[model samples]
Target: MNIDVPRILIAATQSGAGKTTIVSGLLAALRARGLKVCGYKVGPDYIDPGYHRLAGGEPVYNLDTWLTDEQTLLNLFARTSQGADVAVVEGVMGLYDGGAGGVSSSAQIARLLGLPVALVLDAKSMGESAAAVALGFRDYDRRTDLRGVILNRLGSDSHRELVSSALERIGIPVLGALHRDEMLAVRERQMGLLPAEENGDRETVSRMRAAVERGLDLEVLLEAARSAPRLSVPSLPAPARRAARLRVGVARDPAFSFYYPESLSALEERGAELVFFSPLRDSAVPEVDRLVFGGGFPEVFAGELAANLGMKASIRAAAASGVLILAECGGFMYLTKTLRTLEGSVFEMVGLIEAHSAMNARLQTVGYVEAEALKDTVLCPAGTVLQGHEFRFSTVEPEAPERFPWAFQITRKRTGATSLGGCAAPGLLASYLHLNLLGNPACADWFLGIASDASDV
Candidate 1:
């Protein structure tokens, strides 16, 4: 399928280049101009995308090449960006860093979508030297057309002038050089930044709003957007496979809302009805053959979740009865026996799986992962291959040996081996690893396949 979606990607030389602040400000400024702008994050990042959503009233999506195939990624990008004037994609880490060994970087995404790159370079400590960095990034990839440069965190007006002058020699337009502002500092936690949900305090939200307004050059960013070359692709039709299953219950709320829209759409394409229920408020699991619980902040709401006896008991009962359950990080924690907060408080969770999760003051798993199906579960049977990423700060310690074997063996994108949790018990596929459906479209069919087969139960 093809779609003619006009888009631009906000990339960077590397992490800490102020991409978040720049993207956030750009999105806010565009929305303030009353433009219908949709935001897309380049990889499986939960935190940055939260800020993106807050900056604009658009739903955020993760686009990855290694985890999701090219067709699925484009299809999702096309589908989500439909009916919008422009699509703004925010790059992850660096413009070129992807999974292990330089694959699946943001450059890969920009190339795949045929979108221009707006590189944000940190120009605080550099002068004419900034030209070398811009030239290197532009020439290094060759295929990834870097359209413009955004000099971030400038020291002074003279500092901005120096960097902009250097970049001009290389023919890259400087969108704008933003002055370094301490007030633009967003609060941070073990994970990159506290999610927008957790930081909804009136003072904090207002502060963030004001910071973007003051720190960002909105007029300059819009000019950059206007200067972006148009991208044209054939209109691709949505997948037309008939629905294969019906009424699949999805776990949602602030605690479990990390699902990709493509996942639900794929299921719907195969004839599965998607239903959402809040584990935090629902008294019981929705009456459906399949249960899907994606990732979110179960650790932060551990106490309230543990005290939700009705919902906890219902979820446990559903899992124990062999109902197809597909749970990710936060959902993985919800099915466990207990959750230990950073403050040393332990709250009881659903006892469907004999495991306990501990919230640490630091992150436990970060970055992309490759996971192959080891055994039959809700999503796939033995030997089914899958690629995804796991981002979380909660650590799980299994209580009983042989109670639940890991669902898949994890190989990190850049590093060697990474740890993950899974259960072999009938009708359960839960893990800390969150898979973007765009990367693995097969997950939808796998989930529906198992759920449809379980209609008799």
Candidate 2:
């Protein structure tokens, strides 16, 4: 299908160029103007999209080339932003940085979608060199449609003017110039920006809206966005039919809130009703045909989780009672016998698995992985290839072969590293790798089928 959707890609010269800050404010300001603005993230990030959804009051979809094919990305963009006034995509790290060969970079997204790019240059403590940075990015790829520039963290009027003059000489439009202000920044931790569910994010968002209103010219941005040409989106086959009625329970709370919107949506598409429970606060797990526990900062709240012995016991009972379960990363750790924090504090968790995990200062495994299910588990059959990504700073301690039987034979997509990881048993599937059921929406059927039929597992 062909559609003319006004869109602009917000990119950075590098990672810390304040593109997320600008994107958040623009989403709020545009929505304030009564325009139905839609936000999209270009990579495998979940936190930034949370803030974008809070700011724009809409679901922010992710566009990644590696996880999904080009046709899927186009179809997602067309469907999600169908009734919106404009679409804003927040780029990842550097505009050109990605896997081995710039596979899922923001530049690739823009180039494939035929959208214009807005280069955000961090101009603090620099002058014409900012122009050199912009020029390098602009000239690095002649096909990149770098339409405008946004100078961030300008110290003074002279600093703004200096950067502005340098860009004008190079015939690039300056959309906005923002002075360095602490109010424009958001609190962050090791996992990048904190989720919008945290306290005080509303006030921070309000201040960001005010900052953009005062420092930026929204008319210019809207005009550039409207200038994006019509795009020819390729149509693909719709997702297959799913199972009959079924109920699925999900563990959700501050400690276990790292689920992909697509994962849950994929389940819903398969006729599964999701029910959420807090493992840290709830006393009992909800009754459902299947259960899913995604990743989060479980170590930070080890005390609360360990103290909730009632919920832990309930989960243990479910694991033994033949309830289908799919636990990944933090959820995988929570199902272990214990989780030892970096501060040398050990917390007791659900004893569904025989292993214990220890938090490490350095990340143990992170990247896209292809796993072959060693045996028929709750999620897939034996020798079935599964696509997923893993990011963790914790690993199973002692790493004994017999104590922790390997479930999947995993291969890292980025480094070609191979390892025997995760565990699969009767009615159980636990791993550190995060699976994207949304990219291949059909995969949800296999996991959901486990809950439907007793003989499948």
Q: Which window of 10 residues has the lowest lDDT sum in candidate 2?
A: 448-457
Q: In model 2, what is the error at residue 284, expressed in angstroms?
A: 1.2
Supply the global lDDT for candidate 2: 0.83
Alpha-carbon runs more than 4 Å astray in model 1? 1-3, 201-245, 416-420, 450-457
Q: Candidate 2, residues 147-191: lDDT per residue as tens digits?
A: 888889999999898889998999888988889998778778666
Model 1's alpha-carbon lDDT is 0.75
| Top-scoring candidate (lDDT) | 2
Please provide TM-scores, in order, for all candidate models, with all chains considered together.
0.88, 0.95
Q: Per model, state how many residue pairs clash.
A: 12, 0
For candidate 1, the 10 contiguous residues with the lowest summed lDDT are: 448-457
Local distance difference test values of all predictions, in order: 0.75, 0.83
